[model samples]
Target: MANTPHVYVEWRGGTCRVKWWTGEYHENGRKRYESKGGFTDEDTALQHGQDKLYEIRHGINVTNRDGSTPMTQWLDTWIDSISVDHLTLVSYKSLIENHIRPFFKRKSVAEIDVMMFRAFSKKVRSVLKERSADNVIMVFSMVMDDAVKAELRKASPVERKSRRGKYERRVKEKKRPMAIEAVDQLARNTECHLGPSGSSLIWTMAMTGMRPAELYGLRREYCWPAWPASDPDREQREESAERYGADNSMPAIRVEHQVQYVNSKLTLLPPKYQSYRTLVIPDFLASMLARLLASHESDWVFPALEGGSMGSVNFDYRYWRPAADGAEAHDGPRVAKPRPALPAVPSYAGKRLYLLRHGHKEWNDEDGHSRVAVEARQGHELPGVEGVYSNVTPLMERRIMETLQARWIGLQQSRWEGAVKIDSQLFPTG
Candidate 1:
């Protein structure tokens, strides 16, 4: 190659050095060169020049200048580069600033190696709870992983090391599903705390296994199962569905999107994992849903107390707390008398509405349905062979419907035997 590197004794100082041609001319048409010096002898300097020449010819530049990027600086770039909902972004930012940033301090990105990561993990555990520490570690790992992809580091140091000995086993409080009786009672109590309309939320969520956000985003048009054929607009709607290529099948709710607040404004986003599925529900749930729809002209199947989509804060503090733990006089906005509380569901004394979702899975399991159908109904994906070969059958869907209906009937009988009057409208067949 022309203008290649050569080792020589300097004319000015008689010192040994290597001058490498960069193969590029400046704007003024002068050759640009790079030099490495301070060698004690001619042979050493010549060897250095030869090695650099080979690297230049082969396009094998291994310089890692990106390692000089500081942890704090990279973090800012990483956070800005990530794409997520506003709520999730807020959570990641809070953890990065409050938990991760302080530990990393002013360290350069290169300094965070496997050993450094292990020491930081231990340090975080000492200050934070097990779960909190795990969350912080998870976010840090994600940050570092992105850095690796950005070529700021050669490799990621984060790993899920198996814990051993006394500190190894994580203490996980498993959520146990509520009994059919407990579910009915939770629903009845919810009726008292909120109103007749709000009670529908309990049964629908329990039977359908929809995520809370999915339920909140349920529009009037998406509910096919709940709409009976007898409605006056049924034919016109069916015609419209055919024209638009819609699935107007019964016993299903289309889970296309979820309502979430982004910057204090309600935004529609795809369901978790982008699992846009249609959940086939029991006939009992469909009937309950129909009644609910007839009662409200609002677009959402389950609207908030003040209108629009339900807020997590209001649903938790006002609805779930009062429904599970009972409400005192003057509780909630425009409240008056106290409401009687039911016995809290097993493992759900904290009033976690998510347990209803857990309970739905248990019921499906108890009914001896195939794992594929159960997973599909719950919007969860199976792994490996099962995910590939398994499919939900018609028989499985029918079984789910029959089991849920029988459970609702059993609850009615149990209530009747206990000298409690059954509402006629609740069970017209009875």
Candidate 2:
């Protein structure tokens, strides 16, 4: 007599579940039911059972999807069928379109054996050495390897050595941090056009060094204000003037939210690990931020174009690049007509807010906000550790804030004025 099969499903989380089924197996010539498979959710499990029944009846291979296929083709289907965070999707899409698809479009996934993968990897290196394409291959290899473990592939031939060279090169490059003086100069020369708000934002990046994501996510309600502790009696007299009111008030901005694009939706997240902290703010940038806040439309200190959370993509495209050109207009006292010319100062390279955040890590001595803190502020998950940790405290954050504010004002003033010129400073003579 044939035993009837049963499918079991367990809820895993939102729109996800695990599924399995029993199938007949022989143990010492005795027939018995054995668990056959596991799934992510119930609906899929029921569908899986149906598919298995059809496969058994029709003699077809029942699988989630073919693994041995062109890497490009598989990724197209993978991204479509799965739910991924917005920011991750943006990056993953870029990786596929820019690096992966172009490299693997003509290659056949089913026929891609270990030997073929090596050949493909070598070809990638030859085409673009020490570039992001090399890194793409490494990431793709891991994804492919996972498919193999999930029983999606017969095997994967990816080699660790093939990807090791690219990673090693990246590590070596990080040691050569961009010259802080050069970056500071770039900031100073460009401040005039960054606008009061824009200048404050840029300065913030240069000094305390939050990433674009962190900078864009700043809000008015998060600011911190201080009264002179030495003059307590005097502080109360000025307190009324400093307190933020309906029309004007004290200016303070704190670290609270971070901007991240998830599932194609721009959104704000709490400082990674509830890692929100405050800064003392340099007197100058603080003053600038105060002025900027007075002009803001809402509680958001620097709102986006559409009243939604601002994003780094918009920050660079709409603000930074244009402001860079404007700064070049006044770079040093113009001797003659302002002719459009590229600033001898480099654009956002190592000089970006992202790099400034790294500088913050260098100056920060507290337990919670270290280099890892910088990455977290930038909305990036720290390598080998989860996004949030229990150790980050408000005092540590406050110290970081003070460091950032002072750095912003000092670095900008120093850099823009040609204080750190490595080469002969050039200005429009016309």
Candidate 3:
């Protein structure tokens, strides 16, 4: 008859109905009402209406809203809101499209739980490596986290571990550094395949710990030995010279940027961790760099065959593999003889060009350089306040350069002695 608070009861024929104002409104400013009909008595209808009112007051959407948004649609919206690096965005898109979407496409965010995630992880681990599977799970967790923030779901179901047992953690393999002998052999072979320029590139990477992308990004102007006293003056350079001194200013490469290919487009971007650094090379390597620079007309220190930014794939296929694996001569009239294989060390075989960077780290660590200095040189950010206040000092740079110079000299002597011994053996010199 009369309205009882937010609920009212009505009888139609043999059935009774109860309707309640939800105390919420649509965007058009109209009050929303929910109704449950087909009750045998007014008491039952009234009790159900009271229970729904309690749910509405406690922030539950009483319109059966759970599981309405599909996981795929929610992930699409979440990905659109992500503002990350182009490469990172590309990786996220790949994981979502290829891995995540296929499994959870039909499910809603509310329906996903820890058990579902564990099953998904099991399926992913079967197809992918441990690290790769972990990355997929991480991306999925990020999407679920955003869903929780948006109130589409109550919480993220992606747990680091299940209550029953531990999930498989990613096992990081210890990177073995290339020994001095291996480095020398690789460098000499690189020279044979790609000439002095490629040899210089490999040696530089070994000594400097620069990323392959950073090495690819190196410009003629970034080489300090090539810079004239008065040409294109920058404050950073002036400060470095003044602090480190003119005579002690060992030839160095300025690691300001990296060149990477994203979405079929070559893009030059800031180095990883935004760690713009200066890498000083020993005089021996500097001299080699100088000779290499003199022969090249292009601004790029290591240009492609046609001249411009060189791709890693191109470098690996055309230069690195052939140098390491050895190549045969074609049967053309003017074709050169087959080049002999470089020293076949198992450690060096099937290794990427980045190993030289790791070798450099080994050299630095062996030399007992400060952790901060080594990390700074490698363009890695040191954790905590030390990274904020600490910087690579002039003395530290000089010391690093000296240590590198000594190592270079020692390796050269060893190689020379080895060569002489082989010559003597071949000639049977008295």
Candidate 1 residues lying further than 4 Å off, grouped into runs, are 1-64, 84-88, 159-167, 224-250, 328-347, 419-430
User: How many clashing pairs does model 2 include?
Assistant: 28
In order of lDDT, best first, we have 3, 1, 2
Q: Residues 1-430, candidate 1: write the lDDT tens digits.
A: 2223343334236656677665557899987666767877667776776776676677542233467788999889999999986557888999999978888887988778888898899998999998888889989989988887786776788977656646755576676556766666667767766565568788878887888888778777777543322224666547434432353333666777788877777788888777766566776777777787787787777776555666444676777766666544445656565554344443455658887888898898998989999999889899999899998765677678788888888877766765332221132221
> Which 10-residue window in model 3 sums to the lowest lDDT?
421-430
**For model 2, what is the alpha-carbon lDDT of residue 276?**
52
- Which candidate model has the greater TM-score, 1 or 2? 1
Clashing pairs in 1: 225-251
Quote the positional error of residue 169 for candidate 1 in Å. Answer: 3.4
Residue 404 lDDT (model 3): 92
RMSD of candidates 1 onward, in order: 6.5, 12.5, 5.3
Q: What are the TM-scores, per candidate, against the unseen true structure?
A: 0.76, 0.55, 0.81
Give the local distance difference test score of model 1: 0.71
Strongest candidate by TM-score: 3
lDDT of 2 by residue, 1-430 (tens): 1123454444455543323332344577644422334455556566755556555456443243354466666777666755555555566777778766776787655556778777767777777756566677866775676556555565666766654444543454342243445454445444443434555566666554565676778765554333222223464424423433222232334565788866577688765555554334545656666677676665555555455455735666555554443333423575543433436444343233455566555555332456545554444456554544534444544556666555545655655675544234444212
lDDT (Cα, tens digit) per residue for candidate 3, span 1-430: 3468789999999999898987878899987777879999888889888887887788754253544688889888988999887668889999999999999988987888889998999999999998898899999989988887787776788886655766766566555555666666667777766677677888889889999888888888877576423225578768767664565466677787788887677788888767788787788888888888888887778776567766544788777776655455435657564454454444656667777787788899999998888988888888889878888876777789999999878766766654522211221111
Highest lDDT against the true fold, candidate = 3
